[model samples]
Target: MRALARLAVTTLLVAAPLTAVTAAASAVADPTPITVLTSDFEDGTVQGWAGRSAETLAPSTTVAHGGTGSLSVSGRTATWQGPSLDVLDTFVKGTAYTISVWVRTASGSDNARLSVERRTGGVAAYDQVAGNTAVTSGGWTNLTGRYTLATDVEFLRIYVETASTTGAFFIDDVTASYVPALPIQTDIPSVKDVVTEFPVGAAITGAETVTEHGQLLAKHFASVTPGNALKWDATEPSENTFTYTQADPLIAWAKAHGTAVRGHTLVWHNQTPAWVFLGADGQPMTATAEDKELLLGRLENHIRNVAGHYGDDIGVWDVVNEVIDESQADGMRRSTWFTVTGLDYIRTAFRVAREVLPAATLCINDYNTNVAAKRDALFALVSQLRTEGVPVDCVGHQMHINVSWPSVADTRAMLQKFVPLGVEQQITEMDVSIYTGSGESFPAPPADRLLQQAYVYRDMFALFREFAGEITSVTLWGLADDNTWLDTFPVTRKDAPLLFDTVLQAKSAYWGVVDPSKIEQTPPGTSGCAVTYRVTGSWTGGFQGEVKVANTGTTAWTGWTLTWAFTGGQTVTQLWNGTVAQSGTAVTVTNTSWNGAVAGGGSATAGFLGSWTGGNPAPTAFTVNGTACTVL
Candidate 1:
C-alpha cells in the first residue's frame, strides 16, 4: 500500500523516558497498568546495551517496523546470551516496568524471552521478570514482560534475549517503561446486537472459556462456536463409544446464557477417526461394495447419533468440510468418504445431518473462497447440490484472509454467486491475519497499514449489512489472538488476527466494524450528487472498474452514498477507495474517509477489481444520496 501523505515516514528518534512515552493499546491487552517505553530504534545504533557472548547490534534493512533501520542479532543459542539494556540508571529503580521487543526468526526458536533483572553489582541479585514465550518461527512476534524492581537491587537490566536453537533472530522496537491503566472498555455493538436477524459469534478457547469474567462477556455475543470441543475426535474417539462430555458443558453454558450454538462439523476429512474408514477386521477397507456399505454405515451412524443428540438445539451444522479439491479436475476432494461414495458422499452427509437436525441449517464449509478458481469449483459443487434439491441450506465461506490479498470485492463476488441459488451465506471461521510476507511486517504493523486493516473490517461489516437478509451469521474464528490457529498451521508465528488481544480487550478492528463514525467517514446526508460507473480494466473472464461521484447540488455534499445494479451476471471481486456492498443485483458504494466529502461540483472516485462470467454490462442506473444521476 502506498503511504498516505498524512502518515509519511519519519526520520526522527524516539526517547526512552517514561514521561515521553505514549500509551498505545495492544490487540488484546489494554494499556499496561504502568507507563510503557515506546522505542522505534531509529538512532542507527544500539548504544547503552550489553549482552552475553560476542554481541553484534547493527542496523538491518530486511526486517523493520518503520523506516529502513532495525537491529539484527544472530547466533544466540546459550541460555543467557541476548542483547540487554540497562534501564535502571535513567529510569526510577524499583518501579514497575514492562519491556517489549519485536523479534523474528526464519525457522522459529525456543526458550526465547524478555526479562527484567535487578543486580547489586555485576552479579545479578535476582530476576525481576521473565517470559515463557519462544521466538515464533517464520514471522515477527512481540515479546513483552512486566516487572517491578526488587528493593535489594541497585541496577536493572532489560533483556531482549533468546535461548532458542533456531540459529538467527532479528529484533526491533525495544523499550521498557512504567505501565499505566488503559481507559475502561465499554461494550461496543456486536454483530448479534446490531444484526438482530442473525447470530454474531466467537469461538471459545482458553482465553474466552467460561469463567466469572467470561460469563459476564456473554452479553457481548449472541452465539458461540466451540473452537475444538465439538470436533469428531473430541466427541467420539472410540468407534462405538460416542462422548458428549466435552461439548455438554459448552451446550449447557450457551443455553443458560441464551447463546445459540453453531455445531461445527458432523463430518470432516481432517478430524475423523481412522477406525471409521477401516474394516471391521481392523484393517484398511478394500474399495468393494461391502466395504463401502460399512463405511457409509459408520458415517451415517455417527451423524444420526451426534446430530440426533443435539436435535433442535444446534442452530446450524457444517455437514461437510473442504469437500472440493481445486487440484482435481472434477473439483471433489478424494477423502475417505469420497473414496467410498464418490460424488454421492457430499449429498449423503448433508442428507443424514438434515434427517437428524431437520430444523437446523446444514451447510458445506470450505476455505479460500476468495480465490477465483477455488470459488468457481466450490460454487459449482454447492450450486449443483442446490439444483438437485439437496438438503444443503447454506454455503459457508471460511474467509481466513490476509491484510493484502483476496480483496473484499472478491469475497462479495463469491458470496453473491450463491444468492442466485437461493441458499443463505455465512462467513464462518473468519479472521484477518496481518501480512508478514515479503511486503508487510507485523508485531504491530505500520499505522497506515493498520488503518488499512481497520478499513477492511469496517467494510466487511458494511458488506454484511448490505447482504443481511442473505447472510444468516458471521462468526469470528477466535476470541483473542493468543490462541489463534495461525500460531501453528502454515507456520509457527506470532500474530494478531482476531478483534481482541490477549487480554480480551477489543482492538481497532472491532471499532472499525461496529462504529462507522469511529473511522474516517464523510459527514452523513449528502444530497444531489451525480455518479458514473466505468470499466477501468478487463480480461476475458474478469474486469476492473471504478465509480466517480460528484456533488451536483448547490451546496457542498458530505457523506454521500451511491447505489446501482448489475443486470448482467457481472460480479466484483475486489475494491478500493470506498466501501462497496451488494445485495442481490443491487450494489451500494459508500465513501471512505478520504473520499467521503465532495465540495460543490467537486468529484471523487473509487476503484474495484472484479470477475464475471456471461456478461459485463455497465450498470445503467446510478443514484447518489437517493437522487438519480446522469451516467456521464
Candidate 2:
C-alpha cells in the first residue's frame, strides 16, 4: 500500500539577494518584474520548505550552491515526494511570474523538474514551469522558466522533483518574481469585421466580463457561447428544479454588449447530474421500458425549462452534443441516454428544443468530424433522424484540431460531405493545439509551433470563407489561452491554442484570421529528436514509466530504434507499444509494426513497468536510429 503525508515547515521573514533578469519582448510589452521570493538557505534553516508527499526535509551543511548551505530533501518513495513551497498568497491572478531554483543530486544524476500544483473549481492541475533539466552531484543546475497564473485559484504550491529517482537532492537560491501583463493593441482590426457571411464568436466565462478581457471580447467577437454555465449539472441539480445563476450573468453581459448568444447545449454525455440517471428506487436505471420512458420524460422537461428560460436570447442551440462514436457498432455513443432510450433520446432532444425555441437553429454537435469514420457516422445519424422528420437543422463540427494534423483536404471533405445533405454547418469549439500528441508537453508554447498554428488558423479560416453560403457560424473554444479547458484535459500542462495570449493581447493566430500577411512562415523543426521520460506512477520497489520519442525534424521518420543507458540497476520486466532489448545497463527499443511511422513534430510513446535497486537515477542521454536525441 502507498502512504500520503505533507511536511510541516515554518516561513522565514528575512529576504535574500535578488537576481535581475530581462523579460522577452512580444506583441505587448511587459513591465519589469519585481522580486517576491529570495531564499538562499544561508539562515541555516529549512524555512518555507516542505515535502510535497511523504518525505524528510532538513537543512544540510554538506553542499552549497551559494553561501554556506542548502535545503536537503530525502527519504522519498515517489517521484512527487520532494520539497515544495506554498505560494498561495505570493501569486497574483492575471499576472505572469518567472521562477528560478538550483538543484543537484546528492550522489547520482537525475532529470529534475520545477512545477506548480494549482486547484481551480476543485480540480487539481499541474503545470511544468521549466523543461526537465539533467542534474548531477558534480555541480549545481539552474531550473528557470516563466509561468502565467491566468485565473485565481483556491490553492497554489510550487515544487521541485525528479522523474522517477528516489534519491536525495539539494535545493538553493530559489526565487519567484512577478511580471505584469502587457497592454493589448486597440488599433488592430476587429476579427469579425473580416468575415461577412457568418458570425465570428468565442466561448467565455465570468472572468472575461471585466478588465481588458471584457474590452477585447466585446471588440473582436460578434457572438458568444458560455463555456460550462448552461450544462445540466449547473442549471438543474435536483428533480423539477432549475436555476440559471451561472448562465444568467453571461447572457446578460452578451445582451448588454449586443453580442449574440449561442445556447450550448440541451443534452450531452458529460457534465450531467448523476440523479438524472437514477430511478425512483435510488439506483441506476437499466434498459427497461419503464426506465426509457422516465429518462425521456426528464430530458423533455429539462429542455422545456432550460431552453424556454433562455427564450430568444440565444438564437442557436446545440440540441445534442457528442453523440456519435465511430468505434461503436451502431454509430452511437453508449451514454446513459443512449443505453436507456437508444435513438429516441436524440429524437426527443431536437423535437423538444424545436418546440420550445421554434425559430432557433437546432444543431447536433460532435468532435473530430474531420476524420472520415466519425464524420460518416455523424452523417448517417443526422440523415436518418432528419429523414424521420426530426428538426436537425444544422450539423456542428467541433474542429478541435492540432497544428500538424487534419490537412486542408480532409477539412474540405468534411464540409463538402455534409453539403450534399443540405444541412447548415457550423464550426463549433475550434482550437489548434501546438503539440501533435498527448504525450508531448511544453513549459511554454514554442515559437515554431505558434507559427505553424497561425498558418493553420489562416488556412482553416480561408476554407470556411470558401463555404460561406453553407456554413453559418464559427466559434473558438476559448477567447484566449488564459483559461482554456485544454490546460487540464488529456494531461496537465500549459497549452496556448487560442487567438489571444494569456495577457489578453492578440497573437499571430488573431492575425491569421484577420490578415494573413502578418503571419510569418514557420521554420521547420531542427534535424534531431527530443525524448521525454516521465514516471506515470510509483510504489515501494517498482514503478511505471513512459518515454515519448518526438520527431523534432523536418522530415518524417519511419522504422527507428531508440537506445539509452541507465545509471541505476533498473530492469524493464514488462513493456508495451514497442519491442525492448536489455543488456546490463544498456537498453534498446524498436517501434512496433503499427507505430513505426512518425510525422515531423509528432510523437509516439512507449511505457514500461520496472524494478530497481540502490537508486533509480534517470538516464541522461538517448539516441534515435543512431542520431543523438536531446533529453527533455
Candidate 3:
C-alpha cells in the first residue's frame, strides 16, 4: 500500500457554456469557507478538464471575474456538451450547498442553467439539481442558487445556455460550499469484481510444491493467470513450434478449484525465441521491411494459435507487456518489438488477438504509470490504437511499486486520466519492495522491514477502495516472502514483499483484510469503560493493542468481558471479539476472524458496550455502518 502525496493544485473551476450572473453582495469579511462543491463551467482553463465539449475559455466579468476565467460555447441552445470540468473532489449526501457564479447573456432569451450530478461508483453520472434563469444583455449580473444535497450527487456541473446565435456570455466567480453535517455512512467494499489470470494447466517449477502453493493462493485469490510459462520461449521453444505440456498442471488445478485463469502474455520483448529475431541464415536482420514482415507473421501465428487453443477458457490475455518505462525520458522503451516492427506491433497485437479470441479480454500491460511521462506514453499509445480501429479492451498497470516511490495520489491521478479512454484497468503483479540500497546482500529481515511492509499494505488497500469500480483486479506477485522474486532479482537478496511472513504466518498485511481484536473480549474485573488503544504492534495484516481503562470508578467486578461494537457497513467474516475463558488474571482473547489475531500483552486492557448509528465527533470511534458504539 502507498501513501498519497498532497496535490499542489487545490482549487479547481469547471465551467459550462451559459449566461454570466452577478450579485452585489460584498465579499465575506472572513475568508469565505466556500467549498466549490461542483461547478458546471465557471473557472479553470479548458485543458484542465476531461470529456468532449465544444467550449472555449473566454474573459468574463459579472461576479468580479476571479483571476480572469470564463467559458464560451458556440451557437449555444441548451445543448449539453458533457461537463466543462469532469472531475470533482468531495461530494457527500444529505447536506445543503450554495452554487454561485457571475453570468450575463447578449440577449434576454439566453438562459443560464446550473446542475449538480452524481457519478455512479465513480464512473458515470446522473443530474441532481438543474437551476436555470433567463439572462439579459446588460452588465455583469450576479446569480446564486442553493440546493439541498442529494444522496446521489458525487460530481458537479454548470452549463449556460444562450439563445443568441452569435454573441457570447461571460461567467466568473463561482463557488459552492456545504453547511457542515454529520459524516454520512459510506459503505465502500474492499473487493471489486474478481479476475482470473493463471489458467488451468499452467506450470509452476520455481520453488516449493505446486499443490501446496496453489492451495495457499486459492485461499485468498479468486483466480490465477499463467505466471510466465506462456511467454515466447516457454510456449514456443522454436519458430513454428508450440507446446502446452508445462502449462497443463497449473491449468488443471485451477479448473479443479473453480478458479479463473488468464493468459500470461502473447507478445513481449524479453524471453522471445531466437528464430523470430534472426533471418534465414541465422543472423539478426538489418533491413526494417524484412524484420517488420517477420515480426508481424510471428505475432499473427502466435496469437491465432495460442488464443485459439484456450478459446473462451482463459479470461484475459496480456497481448503486449512493459511497453512504457518511467525512466525512459522521452517515451516508450525501444524494445525488440519496437526496434523491428516499430509502433505497428501494438496495433497488430490487439488486432490479431481480436481476430482469434474475439471474446477474450486483451490488455496492454506496463509499469511505473505513477510517473507522468510513462503514463502520457501509455495514454497516447492506447488512444492511437482506439483511433486506428484496434480492439484493445483494457490497460494493465503492473504495480511493481517500491517502498518510497510512486505515492498513492500519483497512482490515483494516473487512473483518473485513463477513465475517459473508456477501457478497464488492472493492477497486475503488485509487489512493494523496501529499498535497502542496490547490490546490498539479502539478510534475515529485521522487525522494521516487516512493520514497513504492513504499513504499505494498509495504505494501498485504503486507496484501492476509492477506485474499485474501474480497477478489474489486483494480483500479488508472489505468495510468500521466500517465494517472492524481490530477493532474487535486480541485484538479488532483498527482503520479503508479500502478505505472508517467511514462516508462512499471516502478517499485518493480512490483518488489514480482517482484524481479530475487533471481535475479542476482555476478562472480568477489567475496567469497563471507553478506552483508547494504541496499535502497539502488528504482523502482516494483524495488530496488537494496549487499551487502558481510566478506571472511572463507577463499578468493579471479579469477572468481566470486554465488549466492543461494530457498525453494519462492513461485515465481519470472522471474530475473536468476545470473552475468552483463560487461566491467570490476564486472559487473551484470540481473534477468530478468518486468518487474523491480536498480539498478547500489546496494550492495556479496557472494556466497553452499547452501539448506535450516529453521534458527535469522536476521532477514535471505530465506525462501521454510520454507527458509533459507546464503551460502557
lDDT leader: 2
Question: Which run of 10 residues does model 3 get worst, by summed lDDT?
Answer: 4-13
Tens-digit per-residue lDDT, 406-464, candidate 3 = 77789888899899999987777777775546754322333344456556666776666
Per-residue lDDT of 207 in model 1: 25
- Identify the runs in model 3 with alpha carbons over 4 angstroms from their true place: 1-211, 326-330, 439-442, 515-632
Candidate with more favorable, higher TM-score: 1 or 2: 2
Q: How close is candidate 3 to the true structure, as a TM-score?
A: 0.50
Question: Global lDDT of each model?
Answer: 0.64, 0.78, 0.51
- The positional error of residue 220 in candidate 1, measured at the CA in angstroms, is 2.1
Local lDDT at 399 for model 2? 89
For candidate 1, the TM-score is 0.56
* Model 2 segments more than 4 A misplaced: 1-29, 32-178, 521-632
Ranking by lDDT: 2, 1, 3
Best by TM-score: 2
For model 2, residues 441-548, the per-residue Cα lDDT tens digits are 654465578888999999999999999999999999777875566654555456788898765677788889989999864332244687766543344455556677
**What lDDT, from 0 to 1, does candidate 1 have?**
0.64
Taking the tens digit of each residue's C-alpha lDDT, what string does model 1 give over 1-632? 00000100000011111111211232123232332454456677765555557756566777675456677766655656677776666555323344557777636466566665555445453342334455665666666533443233476666755554636667776655543323225556654566565677876632243332254247567887776556777678888688775577667777887788888877778766788888878888777787888888888888888888888778888888778788999888887788877767777788888777768998888988778888899889887887787888988888877667677788788878778878889888888776647343222223344456677888877787788889999888766554456543444344567676544456677777777567542222244555545553344566546667766555876688888888877776667778888887888888898767677656677778677788677777688878887554
Candidate closer to the true structure by lDDT (higher is better), 1 or 2? 2
For candidate 1, which ten residues in a row score worst on lDDT?
1-10
